[model samples]
Target chain A: MKEGTSISVSKLTKRFGHFTAVDAISFDVKEGEIFGFLGANGAGKTTAMRMLCGLSMPTSGEATVAGYDLYKQSEKIKKSIGYMSQKFSLYEDLTIKENNRFYGGIYGLSDKQINEKTEFMLHHLHLEDQANTLVKELPLGWKQKLSFSVSMIHDPKIVFLDEPTGGVDPLTRREFWTMIYEAAHRGTTVFVTTHYMDEAEYCDRVSIMVDGKIEALDTPSALTRQFKVQGMADVFVQLARKAKRSDN
Target chain B: MESIQVDHVDKSFQSGKSPVEALKNITFNVKQGELFGLIGPDGAGKTTLFRILTTLMLADKGDAWVDGYHVVKDYEQIRKRVGYMPGRFSLYQDLTVEENLSFFATLFNTTLEENYELVKDIYVQIEPFKKRRAGALSGGMKQKLALSCALIHRPSVLFLDEPTTGVDAVSRQEFWQLLRGLQKQGITILVSTPYMDEASLCDRVALMQNGSIMKIDSPGGIISQFQKPLWAVQGDNMYQLMHDLRHDSRVDTCYPFGQYHHVTFNESTIDIESLKKEFQQKGVHSITIDRTEPTIEDCFMELMNQ
Candidate 1:
């Protein structure tokens, strides 16, 4: 393993009975890099992410996340990474401050640290006034931003965001990407999966999964040049159209 | 005559004690056999407008007509002539693909065989999986099935709300192709999506934000109206470059777009060579700058900021 490699996977494979979800996929994510893992709806992108995040065990693979062994150090890997899923995972019924406090406690932050961090985060997000408001009451954009902030409250080495800006408008989506850029600037490796090709273009490097394998992986420009397409969306369409998988 | 017309439409929903205006003086028209797009972010009133046009809801003020029939007065006529595929997958999940298609056909007092020609191209794609349960189908397959079911009744006008939102890239392209084929058959298509690139596929688009239409023009027309000299810049350190560009007095707007930070000057007369020299002087080395064409997304952002 190279010193600056935040994530490394070799010949990773996952099978569900007769179905192979992720088939012998290999890739490496460098420290502080924004790596886009993209695929069609059933292209095994989520399955690979779950294995790397230590939420699910890979059937067979050699991997390390945040320098911890994927199988032997799953718990340690889980602790070192922050995750924000497609669906907002925060408690909808709880107030913003309350949710932060609850998550901070779960991450094993000291009470003093939690208090200080919560205050800072609330101020940072300009949500100090809405700190007492239920998360469900917030607009979609605010909730998404708040969710991202909460994911990073523990100061994890890495953050995994799945479709973070799925339904947001272009303007709000731009604002969200700025937040991501800040996080990456702060030396946190961002591993994200998204349907938006524009978001894929923002990553430092991107890997397109097709039919349970990493079919293409490179910078957006390289991929576009290789595929002979004008943009990432076109590259995606060209690659995905050749998918032998009839499912998606 | 326009296939669909809206004149000063206004709509609001009672949220708790306050009423939220979902549409504000919205007015647009879709030409006969044209593909019209409602482009915006979530909570921008795309869905509300779609609901009203589809005759599922009523506007508080103004008027809308579908197929030359009034939205309120002739809802039955409008409903019978239009096919609506909502954002959500509303098909029977437990039923097989064939079963769902037949059920929708039966709802319109018709059979799949009777209108097979209308949905043949889309139906054929999912025909191999006709026996598969709708819930078991993949996202793309489900999208195809939903589209097929929508057209099973042979409605002259089609209304699709974010039809390709969650589907994969290839499937989205295929879906749009199906729409084009339907258009060739003279079906007026009205679609809504948050994706800006998809706006280019439409004959004309209404850029909506905060329940109001900001601009209604062809995608090319909208881009042409972006009267700023835009440049895409990339350097060794993107975050620092973004921060520096935003703080620069000459730089009007600087946002990270893909691999480059898309920057527009505050003044049109600013030269790109000087801008590169300024960045180099700021201790940023290896900076590349290119004058880029504005996209629909660029125009949308500029309009929203204004």
Candidate 2:
């Protein structure tokens, strides 16, 4: 174990009946690094992520997330990491302040701590005036930002975001990435999955998964140079062309 | 001749106490065999305009015509001459792939064999799984099946709304290839997507936002009109770089773009050598700057902010 390793996995495998969804994947994420996970749909990216997040049991592997064993200490793992899925999981009917309080309580924050943190969060996001506004009444970009803030309310060491900027306009997408950069600057590790090739370029390192295996992993510039491609999109197309999965 | 035309069209829907204007004075023309794109984000009126052109909805004012037939007065003729694939997967869930294709063909008074040539390229990919229920198909397969069903009737015009929204990168590339093949067969394609990169694939595009057309031009032409020298700048600290660039009086606009910050000058001329020196004086280190070509996304964002 290294001093600042956030996640470490070796020969991790998962199977559903006879189908091997994730096959002997191995990787490590350093503390505060932005890791981008790229793959075509149905290419086992979700299965691998599920296992790493402690949401599902790996068929076989040696792994540690947030300095806890994946199998024996999943509950402890859950507490040390924050997750925001593609689907908006926050309560829409609740006000921004109420939603923050609810998530803070779920993370086992003391009442005094929750109050202080909630006040700081509202002020930080410039949502103090709209703290009483229902989440549904906000625009899509605001709602997405609020959801991200809620995920970080407990101040977990690591955050997993799945397609965080899907369907947003380019301007809003830029704004969202700025927020992500701030989190990484604050020493919070970020693991994100996205289909947008442009977003891949922003990560410190990226891994392209194909057919339940990691086909290529490197910095965006290195991957492009190694593949003799012009950009991350071309690198993705080149790798995806080699995929054996016909379903996606 | 123009295959489709919209002139001063307007549409709105009542929500709560106020009516939300979905389309506002929209006007455009699609030439025969042209691949035209409607590019915008969600709630930008692309779907509403598509519905009006397909004879599925009526405009509050002005007019639209498809295949030389008025959308309102001759909707039956227009519908018969156009193929529409909606944003959502709209095929029968329980029905198999083969069943869906044949059913749509029947509605147009045609047989699968009669128009199989039109959809053969797309259909063959999913033909092996013809017995699989449409709902059971994966996202990419479902997309292929929906496209095949739309083309089974061999309509002169095809309207696809955000067909590749949730599909993967590879499938999205394949879908575009399929559209190119269809265009070669003399079919005019009107497709909508929120992805700005896809706009370049079309012969012409309309950048829409807030129920209005911001600009209408060929993708290349729009990029040419950017009219400012753009530079991609990066430093050791990206977050700090963005903040400093935004505050600089010489910078007109600065936004984070991938690994670097994209900046345009407020003035017509920029002294790159001086700017580099200026950054060093401000305590920023390892600064790299390069002139870069503007893309359709750049044009869209510029117009949107205006």
lDDT of 2 by residue, B1-306 (tens): 999999999999986446889999999999999999999987789999999999999999999999889999999999889989999999998999989988998899898899888888988889989999999998888988988888888899999999988667888888899999999999999999988999999999999987999999999999999968899998877777888899999999998777778899889878888888888788778899999989888999999888
lDDT of each: 0.89, 0.89
Among all candidates shown, the one with the greatest DockQ: 1
Give the local distance difference test score of model 1: 0.89
Model 1's CAPRI class is: medium
Q: What's the lDDT for candidate 2?
A: 0.89
Question: What TM-score would chain B of candidate 1 score versus the native chain B?
Answer: 0.96
Q: Which TM-score value belongs to model 1?
A: 0.96
Model 2 CA lDDT for position B303: 96
For residue B277, what is the lDDT in candidate 1?
87
User: RMSD to the native, candidate 1?
Assistant: 1.8
lDDT of 2 by residue, A1-248 (tens): 67899989899999999988898999999999999999988879888888888999999988999899999999998999999987777898898888988999999998998889889878877888988888876777777887888899889999999988877778888888888988998999999999889899999899998888889999988999999987899989888889887563
In candidate 1, which residue ranges exceed 4 Å CA deviation? A228-230, A246-248
Per-candidate DockQ versus the true complex? 0.68, 0.63
Looking at model 2, residue B131 earns an lDDT score of: 97
